[model samples]
Target: MEREFRICSECGKIMFEGYVIEGGWRYYCSDTCLEKNYTRDEFNEMYGDGDTETYYTEW
Candidate 1:
């Protein structure tokens, strides 16, 4: 299978393919941009199985 790639919206750097839990495609060159867009606490509140512990990994 061929993974799609794109440029990061914040830095304009090359981004690799990855699965998005909320659905749809996403392109982020680094964790910085990802975190900037979807914060850890916010993401856990939405996609997480009510487990806030995993949110700590964002840092």
Candidate 2:
């Protein structure tokens, strides 16, 4: 038998079987989301203070 998965909620991209992790699947398109999750507070350090705002607006 085979299994199926849902698209990432934040990006509307399809997620494949192996991509899912133990607790649950990721919420966004790729490692982009994972990085953002771990380093949101440091966004200013990487891209400046208003960069996070720009990301949401562009999305």
Candidate 3:
């Protein structure tokens, strides 16, 4: 199997595992990174107004 590495959208850290990918397919290693990469307003604009749980859970 090939390894998958993702760079954190905020910190540019190389991630071998845990990921918090955004709707636009941006990769983040943690909630901190995700938050830093986007604001609440930006998230809503990109994903629409709704509970964020669904956003993280569905993927």
Candidate 4:
């Protein structure tokens, strides 16, 4: 049982869920934070329910 910690690219909050977008490597703690950087349509085309696990963040 291993839970990874991640940081929200939008609010800089710590997240227990280790999910992130591929290629660009963008990460968000919630949909609100994700939507800030991507349009609804764009996000839909991205890695849904993804995994880029860790306590890492891309600025």
Which one wins on lDDT?
A: 4
* Residue range 1-59, candidate 4, lDDT tens digits: 65567677789898876337664365678778877887777766664444423222433
Identify the superior model by lDDT, candidate 1 or candidate 4: 4
RMSD of 1: 6.5
TM-score of each: 0.44, 0.35, 0.46, 0.63
**How does candidate 2 fare on TM-score?**
0.35
lDDT of each: 0.52, 0.43, 0.58, 0.62
Model 2 lowest lDDT segment of ten: 50-59
lDDT of 2 at 55: 27
lDDT of 3 by residue, 1-59 (tens): 76767676678887764434454367766667767767756655655554332144312
TM-score computed on alpha carbons, candidate 3: 0.46
Q: Which of candidates 1 and 2 reaches a greater lDDT? A: 1
lDDT at residue 14 of model 3 (Cα atoms): 78
**lDDT score, candidate 3, position 54:** 19
Q: Which stretches of candidate 1 lie over 4 Å from their true place?
A: 1-3, 18-26, 49-59
Clashing pairs in 3: none
Q: Candidate 1 lDDT, tens digit per residue, 1-59?
A: 75566555667775564324344344455567768787767666755774433222111
Using TM-score, give the best candidate's number.
4
**Cα RMSD to native, each candidate?**
6.5, 11.0, 4.8, 6.3
Locate the minimum summed-lDDT window of 10 residues in model 4: 50-59
lDDT of model 3, residue 4: 68
Which has the better TM-score: candidate 1, or candidate 3? 3
How do these models rank on lDDT, best leading?
A: 4, 3, 1, 2
